[model samples]
Target: MKAFLASLVVALVVAVGAAWLLETTYQSTAADAYATNGARVGDPGHNLVGTDWYSSRS
Candidate 1:
């Protein structure tokens, strides 16, 4: 049981490391993809969470 727990911990560590590596390698590509998708940074598109969150044009 102890050996199995140790192996599980090692595997989790390796998986997390691989995920971090991939994210680092593709960081720019991911950002470019998102930017190209018209999602524009800093623009979350107001959907009105409440009436008080917006002001009337009239």
Candidate 2:
């Protein structure tokens, strides 16, 4: 039981770490693609034609 618990903990740690790494990598790639396409990162209206309704909400 102890060994199983230890293995489970290790697996959880590895899974969490992998998920974090992939998320970071994806964000970096997305930012690069956005910049390449002339869209400003983090801007809601970067590529939109009309006003960003979400940001314009009062």
Candidate 3:
């Protein structure tokens, strides 16, 4: 029982960390995509995933 509890705690921590890492990675990719396109992304106020990148406007 003690071992099970310990394992559960470890699993929870791992899950939380993995989720955070994935979120950051995804957001970065979205920002990069917008930047590569070179058209200003309008405000939805916040990034859906990654950094908020303002593209060059004509």
Candidate 4:
């Protein structure tokens, strides 16, 4: 049980850290767009996300 708890905590920490890094990366860049079509940078209608959180709006 102790080992399980330790692993769980470690997993949680890693998950949180990864999420934070991804959020920061997404927010810091304006060239990337989280669109369903998966287009390249500098293309028209990139549908950029304005906020730090994930948005459904294109």
Instruction: Choose the strongest candidate by TM-score.
Output: 4
lDDT of 3 by residue, 1-58 (tens): 9999999999999999999988977555444568655767665446465565566895
Q: Rate the local accuracy (lDDT) of all candidates.
A: 0.72, 0.75, 0.74, 0.71
TM-score against native, each model: 0.44, 0.45, 0.45, 0.47
Residues 1-58 of candidate 1: C-alpha lDDT, one tens digit per residue: 9999999999999999999997888556434567765765544445438656665775
How large is the C-alpha RMSD of every model relative to the true structure? 9.1, 6.8, 10.8, 8.1
Per residue, candidate 2 scores C-alpha lDDT tens digits across 1-58 of 9999999999999999999988987555556667755675675546667754465567
lDDT of 4 by residue, 2-39 (tens): 99999999999999999999888756443455444565
lDDT of 4 at 46: 50
- Evaluated at residue 35, the lDDT of candidate 2 is 72
The runs of at least 3 residues in candidate 1 whose Cα sits more than 4 Å from the true structure, single-residue gaps closed, are: 26-58
Instruction: TM-score for candidate 1, please give it.
Output: 0.44
What lDDT, from 0 to 1, does candidate 2 have?
0.75
Candidate 4 lDDT (Cα, 0 to 1): 0.71
- Sorted on lDDT, highest at the top, how do the candidates line up? 2, 3, 1, 4
When summed lDDT is taken over every stretch of 10 residues in candidate 3, the lowest stretch is 27-36
Clash total of candidate 4: 0
Which ten-residue region of model 2 has the weakest summed lDDT? Answer: 44-53
lDDT of candidate model 3 versus the reference? 0.74
Stretches of candidate 2 off by over 4 Å are: 26-58
